[model samples]
Target: MNINLLKLDFKNIRDFRELTIPLFKEKDVNTPFHISLIQMPNGTGKTTAINLLRSIVCGEILEKEIVLSYQPTRYKCDEGYFGVLLIIDRDLYSLGMHFDYRNGVMKYETSRPKEVGGGKSFSYDLPPYIRNVMTKNFTRLFVFDGEFSENILDNKKTEAETSIKFLYFLDRLELLKIKADTLLENKRKSTKDTKVHTQQGLTKLETEEKKLKQTLVDLNKQLKKFKEESVSTSQEIEDLEKKNDELLSENETIQAEFIEFTTKISSLENDIRNGTNIILNILRTPSQFSLKMNDKLKNLSENMSKLKLPRSVSSEFFKELSDEDECICGRPILNDSIKKKILEKAEQYLAADHITTTNCIKGSIRNMDDYKELSNLRDNLYSYINEKQQLIQAKDLLKLRLDEKDQEKAEKIKQEIIRLSSNLVDLNLYIQSLETKNSAFQEEFSLNEYENINLCQKKLIEKRKRLDEASDTVNFSNGVSLFKKMMDNIISSSIDKIKEDLISKSNTRISQLMGNKDVVLEKIEGCIYVDGKKGVSQGQSLAVAYAFLSTLFEDSPHKVPFIVDSPVGSLDLKVRREVSDLIPKLFAQLIVFIISSERNGFVEGIGKYEDVQFLTIYKDERETGSIAFHTDKKFFMQFHSENEEVQV
Candidate 1:
């Protein structure tokens, strides 16, 4: 379950005419070094290498344009190659991608372990478990760049949630549920007529079911469209607002006031976001929201304590009692009848596992005593709302002054802002309607049941159930339904458990890297959210992302390499040192693609570790091929790109 990169080779691909970068030191393939820092100056094929690595692992089907993009510019060549050697769990494997630029075709080949006769296959021949989950989305989790940090925080991207599901094999459980649904549908189809229902009734039910299924499909498509449109509209509004701000700043008379207002507004927004996070956290526990619930929990705890509930008698005790000829009280249990009765009663007692779960629940309920935090959170929420309103009024006043200074341009910008804001509002409302669950008595046109995914799904399930009943496949349908419900519950509970554990571990790492507890990760829905800010700096984002990934992969059965481009380029000196200190211990193999500029503090920090291998790759004088320099720390520290070309 541990995968290490052994070597990466390229031929006629990008700037690399021929290259073999050994990821290990002293030719020790059995135990690769923990860190491999490949210093490639800007545009020397760092991105190409990263992309090819992802494509190889994920078995990505290359587009025509992408295939041609890999052709080297140095010479005329119709073919190119990129290959990676990997050691997975002590087994050697190599994956190669053959590119034919003339035909815009890319073919993959993999070599198996020596035990399997060591033959090459013209396909991705990864182990079953690894291949099953090595999706493009999952591969991007480890084989990524600095932009991954920002992507993990975007609300519209499900990278965070999808990674968790895939890593934990929750997606597999979902697939099982889908299989169960398929089985039920097949059973319904096979049973066309039942003892109680005629063929006509069954046919009518089937028609209705088909209609409902189609309705669900259409509703889902509409939902996806709305969600996508919402993201684009939000971006448009943000861009327009930035343009307006720039326009306002151009006027000398209002520039100073505008800058002051912008700062204050930004600060207030952060405050509001933080306050909302705190309130949401406090509200998660219902006892904190109501004094009555708190009292009830307290009373339950007291009663359980008085009654000696979760009694000392365990199933094991009963089991032992039944096994003995005489009872613990010295009663004569030589009779077979007595032993049988005792054995029968054993099932009524709590088992060890149940007792442990009960104790955990009791402890949680016993600890719910304070409601003051909720009251304070409510007050803070109100304060933030009032402050936001004040900031809005101040911004409006500033806009008024700008309008007087330059009416024509100001009015144009103002009108555009107004229009975009209105559109954004409508988009948000529509998104909400699609997500909302409609009640039976709700007006049809206000929010149609078919328009909402939740409601439409409910209707589909009901129709399917009726069809199953009419077709006399009730037993199979019920079994499948129960199985689906069990899977759904497990998925939900697993997500919650993993999220809690990940948040705790990630926050600890974040605190260490940031040197304080100022940055708190409040939740992980589609992405990671900080306690009081809408956005974090690039450095913080990277730190947060690495912390999250490290925690996620800590206990995974598969230990994969972490390949990154410019791992510490965006961070400051202090953060770079912290990251360098923390990242090496988190992964089994770390491959970093860096430029000379990032070597100041980061290289020194990680270079202190003896297990690091440093190498530099740069373009040759003619810019036709790349040159690789295998160097020690001294040389790596002194090396800088002489090519005056700007880094992309």
Candidate 2:
């Protein structure tokens, strides 16, 4: 519904002892202008006019002192009041209030014409919907500054959504949802505390669950450590076994080498002994036999020289002739003296032969150099024996050392290997025991954990059921608050579609205004986007804001005038023109509060539109008083105790 301003009459209003303001003449009231440009200078009762109009439309009670102070000293010691007449949807209504400053009391009254009031007038009888229509939040939509416009356009602002909701009356629905949520939360808390389980039991269970979780975590850590240690021990055993195998192979090679060396030493010792014995016997026999042979040769020479008569005969031949008793003359002399002489002659011949031969052999043996050659051979054999013995001793020592090392170290290694195997067995046994224990613990923990979770979940489910029942009761108690929340959800679900349409329409308006689509407006996750980014300039921001308001108004089921103060003042020339042109089409009656600086741009943009009023506020030169001027105007102005008419 369009709220058309009719007239405002006041006694003792600010800066006026009495004042009457006519928004439209009697003739124009029937043909109200769709647009009106109220040109008001700085601080000339324009703000007061807005406040009084809001009070009249929304039944706001003003303070007596504040109302009296409007006329300065006119009613400082007395009572004062203001009255407003409005034509809403072709129906006439009057809202008036009287202030008693001395008594600090105020009285508000409203009247509908007898024709529309069913033959009875009700004081302050504004309909609830109409009363709801003009609120602080909704007022900002119609009456706001550049800051509000900026907030409306800001993508990051929370108020943007709030303003939209307020404008569309969605805030009421959201408020219901909030109340339902609060009730549900309270019900949940009450159910959790008082249903299915005691608070103490729940707390104790939670604490136990925490401890069990911690214990499980610690056990898992220990299990990991133990497993790692087992792997490490196994690896160590494998490495040691491999090393022991290498050592065993090395020991076998050493033993084999030692045996081979010992065999060679033994052969060398036999050779040394045989060589030494043979050479020593030769040395002893040769030296002793040489002396004996020399003595024997001298004796033979002396005996043979004493007895020899012939040089060719030997002693054996002479002895044989004496035994035969015959001589070479063949004479058989029987006399003893003859036989003896013959025998003696033969012996002497044989002995002389023997002496000569023996001396010749001795001379040849002395020239042969046998003793020097034998001595040299014995010395060489002795040297060779000594070298062989030394070599044998070295071999023996080497064999002994090898045996010692092999025995000593092999035994130690074998013992260690045995001990390592035993230790490995022990570790395996211990690890097995630990694993068994770990398994038992894991099984126990699993069971405990399952039971704990199951019990908690069961209790929680039971409590949640109770809470649901309680919430239903609360909703019943609160009268369809739950239904309203469900409706909110349903509405919320469809908001995306609404937002899509809003985005489409807003972009259309922006495109029409700016003559380009460079700043494509979109909404994502409840935020405005300017070409997929945020924070446009003030002009662009205002353009976006205008587009949003246009969309909101177009979509709203209610019809209301667009009352704005300096709506496009913050905009640049081009944007101001676009906004000025676009706003006229959005609202049936566009009431703009503009100063002189803003007038030319709006007039050039929208002055050609029919039924547009250009009302200028005329301030007295003293600047202490002001009045609105219109060609067709009539109103009541009351003096201290009288009524009058002030018109221009």
Candidate 3:
């Protein structure tokens, strides 16, 4: 699958009243220019263009506020339009979004190839494969801005993992598993409701399953809402603290003490957060945290080794022997008593499924390290708790001093802070309770199985098994289970391979970009991280991000255009040149939104390519619209914004 950008059109949107910029060369619609550089100054529609491109490709629903934000500022406009023309594997398509500012409504329109004669439709009419692959998350990978560089490195974000899953079709495999589950469910529903007692059992189980499913859904929604509220509340608290600091700036004596306490409290809070993360990571491996579990696992492993639990001969061997005409000692097994005895003894050995499970457990236990880490884990947990206690004390002392200086204002702020803090604590505790898995020591924490996703899923599976047995669809259920397991194994191995390859390729490119700088990509779990570094400069971050994304898209089956805003604006001269030279070769088409400030080294490097198109667009000072000038490299390099403002 190949997607090439041909042109973009805008009307009554942002700074552009009417505009069209060709993304390809003259007399070419089938093939896009290798490099199409569009230079736009600050206050122009560069950001709006990027957003519209993403919306068109992914068919995202526009919020009411977002739709109104695109209205033209120069004059009254009732509506606006943004359209994108592209070719997907030789088929021409045009996607358009019409925004009604009055009603806060946005409608989509799609035009297919002339051969199909499907004039215009008020919906996205893309092919199934294209729709499936061009998800919002995937679209953001190609159509993005410099902020994405920071997002790719943030540990809380899953941008790197999501890109791999979507680009490599692992998400599709997951969807197939979901479909299998749905099919099995339909089979259960279609079973004959013959016996009243058995039907009642199935009904009860189905009702319980539905209730559990709804509970899971509600819990997920609450989790998302709480997370959003957490971020907003934290920001609000920070803003209020800054305001308090400004109020205290009038009194030097008190201000100095306040600043000192604030700084220490902030430091302690950060330390607590980091410590909590570390403890959570340790808890993910329960055996490393509990001595009792460690000893039990070790004992189990040793006993399995001694007893040869899986055994050298399985029950299948005995069953085959029972079917033989004679015994191994040359005795006549034609005797019915001898065959019956052999068959009866076969039940004593492990079946194939049991053997496989035993082997897996044995391997897992054998691979675990000795219980030395338990002590270290305990120490870490203690240190984290100590830090948390210190943080609370510091916050309380700060409030006390604030109350001494200004009672009325400080009292109000302190009360608000306390309320917010309590809310945050409750949210955090609930989130942890919902996310934690069941363990042997769950009772110690009074963990409820119904509140936890993992435990609820386990109960759901058990109920499903009972229903399957009642419906006499055990064979079908087993087949679906096996298929799901196979898919899981394939997806896991594929992701592992992709992660290994991406890390190697990204590090190679990072080295090339950084030269002698010791920037090595150490891992790509939820996000990309550098070796032995807490953070990198903005330039280095951008370089690392480009390296990662270029490698990610290099071998993908879909050849989508790389459309980026300020691709090299944050980069230094050397990194800008490196990125410019490397990025064009990794994608089918490159459409970069740049301001005049990024033209020093980036334009020179990219201009070296033969198939490059340069164009400049900006707001017209005398008119109520914008102007698009089809220019050469000379004009593009020299042009500057009239206001001399730099786009961030």
Which candidate number maximizes TM-score?
Answer: 1
lDDT tens string, model 1, 25-79?
Answer: 6767667788999998888889999999998998898998999999977678899
Candidate that would win on lDDT: 1
Task: State the weakest 10-residue window (summed lDDT) of model 2.
Answer: 635-644
- Weakest 10 consecutive residues, lDDT, candidate 3? 192-201
lDDT of candidate 2 over 1-648, digit per residue (tens): 656666667665565545665556457654456777776665556677676666656666667555544544422545556787667777777777766656666677777766665332335666566787877677667655556666665566755566666776767776767777677566656655443233444455556556655554554555566667667766776776555445544555455655565566567577667766766666564434376665665565566567542355566665565555455568555567775766677654546556676667656544432332456556666776677677555543442344566556646655776776676676655444334534464455454332333333444555555545554544444555547757778666656667777889888878776677777676734446556244355556566766777677777766666667777764567767766766786667667776656654656777668777666655454544444354321210111111211110
Global Cα lDDT for candidate 2 = 0.60
TM-score of each: 0.53, 0.48, 0.52
RMSD of each: 39.3, 48.6, 37.7
Q: What TM-score does prediction 1 earn?
A: 0.53
Better of 2 and 3 by TM-score: 3
Candidate with better TM-score, 1 vs 2: 1
Better of 1 and 3 by TM-score: 1
Note the Cα lDDT for every prediction shown: 0.80, 0.60, 0.78
> Over 4 Å off in model 3, which ranges?
27-29, 154-156, 176-489, 504-522, 530-541, 628-630, 642-648
Q: Compared to the true structure, candidate 3 yields what TM-score?
A: 0.52
